[model samples]
Target: MAADGTFSPVPTGEKSPEGAIGPRSNTGQKGGAGALIDYCTVVLPESSIEDHGVTWLPNLIGQLFGTNGAIVVGSIRNKPWQFYSQSAVLLDREGEMVGRVGLGGNGSTICVSLSGAGCRWVTRWDNVAKAVERWRGKLSRVDVAYDDYDGECLDVHALRERAAQGDFASGGRPPMHRFLSDEGHGTGCTLYVGAKGHKELCVYEKGKQLGLKTSPWVRAEVRMYGKHTALPLDVLTRPLDYLRGAYSVLQEIITGFCTRIRTTRKAVEATGTAMVEWMHRQVGPAINLLREAFGASWADFAEVHIAREGHPGRFRGVAKGDRLAQLMREELCPS
Candidate 1:
């Protein structure tokens, strides 16, 4: 209610109450850097405005208003700050007013939050295309924040918590994002969780930047899958009959293999920064299996390659008996 005898009740909803200062409306939206929203407010214990930072506002407003908004400056209770709308002001601790700032549109809508010494505003996008054009290049970085540490180390559970919080970098913050992976010695999905409320499964490869999506059917093989290696025929029986026994065994093995490969690929993509410990724990056995499989597939091709180096004749028959002896003799005899 206002100072006048007007009646006002708070807005209520499942996510947030109306008229209450919750987070931004786009708090969990996702898109490229240009559409990113980067704003932070450090609310003080007191009820008035204090000092604040302007570094994240420009990109933030650019995402919100496009490129037509403008900022106007003025004094508010003798506080120094910038305002996107003339009515909205960002205050400094010294109480000196700056100006109103926006993408410069005549009828742009905006959202604002006022705390002690800090203020944030999300101007509505009037010219989204123009805004994307004007601010896309200017926005650099993808800042990723994670969930609070609950007296636990960074692991899969922590990663799950981060995913629950949507902790991946968004709204053109900065590229320096962070995330946790499953710490348990088991196989699991690779995830990219946003801090401001976003999460996605990703296929990250080593020495890469972006992550890829994994096949929904594949899953990591952990200790729970047990150490008993089954023959190709054993897995084909009963409930394992997914494809009607027509190579169902192959399908399951391939799915399991793909899952492991995708997880490793994701680790490679993020260059292990996001899931290093998890990768280190799983990659060794995965690589060994790959090598063994590759070796078995091309076993006969090995002799053919050696003969192709100019042996001619019945190389296969002649090459078999003295292959090791010939190799050592050639090395010792030089040329």
Candidate 2:
């Protein structure tokens, strides 16, 4: 709350679209720089107007952010958020809003959110973290985003394929996912894993998002909710590690592939990520019913029917040899 027994406020950024770890890795090696702390929301520990003054809100921000650039640009008359009801926008050297504060009366919880640019501009995270530590602030949410330039790691298509193959599944089942494309509208594409309020991940074309029609830059982001999990301030210092910990697939950075190993695989039917969906809808039920009715003899009839059929109608024409092998190669894309 403000010193005058009023309130303070945050910037107006879009909240996560409603609808929407594997391990603890200490590998601070290469590529951590690629991850960006695009968004952050922290709730200040219990506070009162008596301890600090009406100006205490800004003063607290100044101490945590190490600057007096907080312009009390908001009040109850112009609340930035619906809950906090009052706010102040924290400006940087460039007068850009690096962060915003949400405050109400004494004992009312205060909230603060830093934007993508704000996260990059804040260089004193470690020092300010100490101040927050003393106050015992709690992180409500944080988004760790990584840009895979030209899909150096993996693109949206790869993510969709992998999810279909259950590569992103940490628990036994893969999370729900949806793919949205501009369909040549020039807006770009996006892949969403899981949903809101749950562990969610969004992988999209960053360059295309910026209007680069042909740019291949893909960005992957993981949003963490501290409502149930304990979020440490170290997430700010090592966002990349946290991101990798979100999905085991993300940790497998594709550096490239060796031609020798690529050509040495055994000759088997070319099945890709789509194989799972097809099997579930087509093969699984039929086999289950056959087994239920015929018992051990189900295989005799089912396998005989499948073998006699030779190949499914869809694969009747994309027969073996180089043409069929090419289909397999495409599915094993390095990207």
Candidate 3:
């Protein structure tokens, strides 16, 4: 979409002061604070009714990011993506779309991905992690990056040489790397390790990419994918560690962190919350298959009203804490 122009910042004064906008942490061994998470895609399972609706994301963002900015949506295109539809843009305090939300996908899942701006806009990383835990969300992709303005500590050519020296070697099998350049087009060069399956590392010239040809700014990024593999939430807390662990070359460069081993997440018990996640994970595929083969009418399952917990904003039309009683008595219920 033609997303770039001027996005109006959500108005705030007494109710929410400018102080509500948190400060950003700088993380560079030299020049600037650039150690950061640049991209992330969080996947969440949806109950049959919760999966498809215009109001779902509009209702959820305030609670999810704790932002008072009103939600506005756009499109992920008219076509379905990863089987999801009705995608919305995530609102920052500036009212700009820093991320996207998708609903009505396979297994009735909702997928959310935040761009570099979104990751930086959300200051409370702990709250995000806590929300994911509370909602049983699985992070499908998380990218951690560190900038080297002087290119003193990290260099693409240096990394390439390290790869040749077997410094990037993992499990006695060195990561595959490929070098790509615009060839004097002033677009800068990139060195990719492991290149795009499960986990990868990327090194590039940041300044050149931003149109500053004389800049010494370089960036090294590590990307971890949880699609086919398990991703621990620790990456949210200790991103630097995970970044360094992506390669031995990185471990040697990014100092003060020594943990190179991958962490394992514990299996969740089939509790109510886990069951919600499990239903989408374990049972959702079957439901989706039936929906595809027959149709929504032909493929349906019964939902038992086991309990009533009043949590508003998590679902559409659920305001404050009063709607649980009404929802249980709604016509959608199989009374």
Candidate 4:
């Protein structure tokens, strides 16, 4: 809404007109060192505008850039229309409002403009890469990867044969003991208890269809399909303690494995059941640890799943349960 009590429509699809305040500038980039100065001018449609809601933009900006770094400078209201400016005024960590983000247009179509100086000021003291990495870390699932062997790569059959001969842990590498094996898909899959007492499953598959003269390489991946927790950046940055917590949780799961798997099926069914049970037990304590570390805010965003009857069952983030179920199904039954 304009100051004169007239309703203005937000612009759609088109770029902000020249000389317009806070017009999108091409001089800035989205990430890296130049990210702070990068101006993003998006003319959203009615649907997008509604999706963002009135307060969402301000809140998001506040979260990304500290509250001191951004503020609502001015706002106007008319029937069914409201407008405000989110100025990136603070130029440094000291919290000084030295610049502004030009916000124009009205309810139907609005334009957000940023000056080159404003962009630079916004990014001057900001570590864009680290900030983005932190956000990504919050949204990412924790995965633990292990390298079974570092020497010459061996085919799945040869690897299994060597495992049968107890060759994997005889060297300086951590001693690994196999508890379950599955070859239902022609690929060799084995669950092992490492010397560190961590339980991991390795799937070895031979790549096919190389060039006429080239031999297909053997490929393998070690997976610890336990609890999937999207922890906050602060917790992730201090990984030593978090890892210790994880080790404790994994150790508990491994120690209780025998009691849980009293009755098992053939290779595939047995391995799947074990994996599912481990994941199920992994959720409670993992979520507790995350709640302790990141507080309740993370519960709203983190997706945790437990397995039921060899399939993924909801433990948290039920809104995304179906998607999580689909992903787990595909992973467990790749074919």
Candidate 5:
């Protein structure tokens, strides 16, 4: 257990496998795009989900990491609102739960915990669009809950009013707005209904304020919750289907949230590279499967890179740092 009393399932002193992807450090300065390739190689092969029979959440959680990759936490009740821990609650070396994953009730909720470093590499709008494509047809609603502690003074009431006006809805479509609490004031809490019937988007503030004098950085809790009646509890038990669906939804939420938040150019590029590299590393069979399933392609990946670099403005050219340039070169010209 950690000092905070939460349990981390990761074992102590266990190093990441020889070629694992993602940052080994908290800051994500070391790995670059190579980490993404390693990560995809690691998770892509185990992407298959099978019926493992009914099991408890705790028992199912233990199988999600290491060689097995992500799997569904099965429930016997076959309830419409199935709960999952998301990919964020990975175990540490001591098997302690490092980082946090939200647990709540909704029609169907998929949670993903992004490390400080992982957040830089994994979240983007294009990536989200691709991830959610498979489940898009079945989705009835989508909600996002993001934690904001960047010291931006946000007026909750104004946001709610805007939501009421459909300002948040895309394409001039109006969304049903509701406040989570009776307090009319906003602490950066608001929900927007998806233009698609039954779809919803939620953005909420997380973490706690220390005192008037010591305000901690705010953590955002952005969730993508929706209603998909087509996915009954029994079908969710199938690991591959569950993972595919969860991965899509989780990526969508993360991408949407990151796009809204402020980030550095370097960080965005690194993340875009990681996202693309991971897609490229998918197994031939899996690639074909994904293509057949969602019409995904390498062509779409260009958007991720472009979004990260930003659209051309008055500035004609942006210089790249030595490290970043090297990473980009390597990705462009794989050794």
Candidate 6:
């Protein structure tokens, strides 16, 4: 979108002051005019539904009555609204439930579901409830309660700390008494989700060690735990993060000159004219995907950090007292 070709500082005076600010104009193409790409956005509570509507919302007025954004929007339409799972909670190494600021809906749910499914599938959570109960009893006999924590409210830094402690080798594994059915009897239960130790073959780096060990029950060496969690080896985050970061950086760099060329209408006109062309050449693929996959919600990913120009970070940060934190407590973690 073209920014209104004005770079005046927002006036602070209660009343309009004459010539309070200098005239500055920076113009670029007013509308996006480039090939579309598919992209996925990590939903955040603060993420604007209106912005997402641009790409996903059904068009009330149009010839086809729909566009690529609508189709892409439909893909993730059934995503759960809660940020955290009411039934499940994550624990860090210290055994103190990690605190986060967001809900466990969207990406977090997917990650948990996938992790649980990947680790234990055929067993099924519903069926496994009995097993979990049995295990809890065994562990309780040993004086342990099944630990619970949620991912939605934790900050990335906090998650990192917890992850470091949760690993089996790093002294992070939950107490045997907490997770096992019977430490002495070993008859009550075991960590059975569905299929135990299914390795996600999509992303595995043979050389780089992600720094964690896996269960002996795991068949193939390529497991998805430790560093291989959700982060893809080649791509980072959801793939959208890299593209968005690059786009934002490039946009900033290009717009930085807007101030210099504000007075030069010709330059403004030239840049505006080239904007579409530049975007097409550089970010067209990612943008198109973002629109297709996530629609206007792409903005939610705008602030996501990119470790490399091409890779996106898997985690989003939550500070101490953000609304997301409150939501996590109210919905996922009750005091």
Return the top candidate by lDDT: 2
lDDT of 4 by residue, 251-315 (tens): 11111101001111112232344455565686767767767877876565464433234333222
TM-score of each: 0.17, 0.59, 0.61, 0.21, 0.29, 0.16
Every model's Cα RMSD, please? Answer: 25.9, 21.5, 23.1, 24.9, 22.5, 26.7
Q: Tens-digit lDDT track for model 5 on 1-335?
A: 12332212122232223322112221222222111111110111111211333133444333332113222232223232224333334433323333333334432343333233322233222232233332232222222222233535334455566666655543444545567652533222434334333333444432111111122223322222233332222111111112112222222222112222232333333344444544567555665664576575543653553237432221112122464455455544567
Q: TM-score for model 6?
A: 0.16
Expressed as tens digits, the lDDT of each residue in 188-279 for candidate 2 is 78999877764688998765665445666677888876656546776655565566667667655522211111211211122333344468
Highest TM-score, which number? 3
What lDDT does model 4 reach? 0.31
Predictions ranked by TM-score, top down? 3, 2, 5, 4, 1, 6
Weakest lDDT window of 10 consecutive positions for candidate 3: 261-270
Model 4 TM-score (2 dp): 0.21
Candidates 5 and 6 compared by TM-score, better number:
5
How well is each residue in 190-278 modelled by candidate 6, as lDDT tens digits? 33111112211111111111111111111001112222122221111111111112212111211111111111222222223334445
Off by over 4 Å in 5: 1-63, 67-147, 153-155, 180-199, 207-222, 225-335
Q: How much lDDT does candidate 3 score? A: 0.56
lDDT of 1 at 61: 41
List residue ranges in candidate 1 displaced over 4 A: 1-36, 39-120, 123-129, 132-137, 142-157, 160-335
Error of 2 at 284 (Å): 60
Candidate 5 structure, TM-score to reference: 0.29
Full ranking by lDDT? 2, 3, 4, 5, 1, 6
Residue-level error in angstroms, candidate 6, position 328: 43
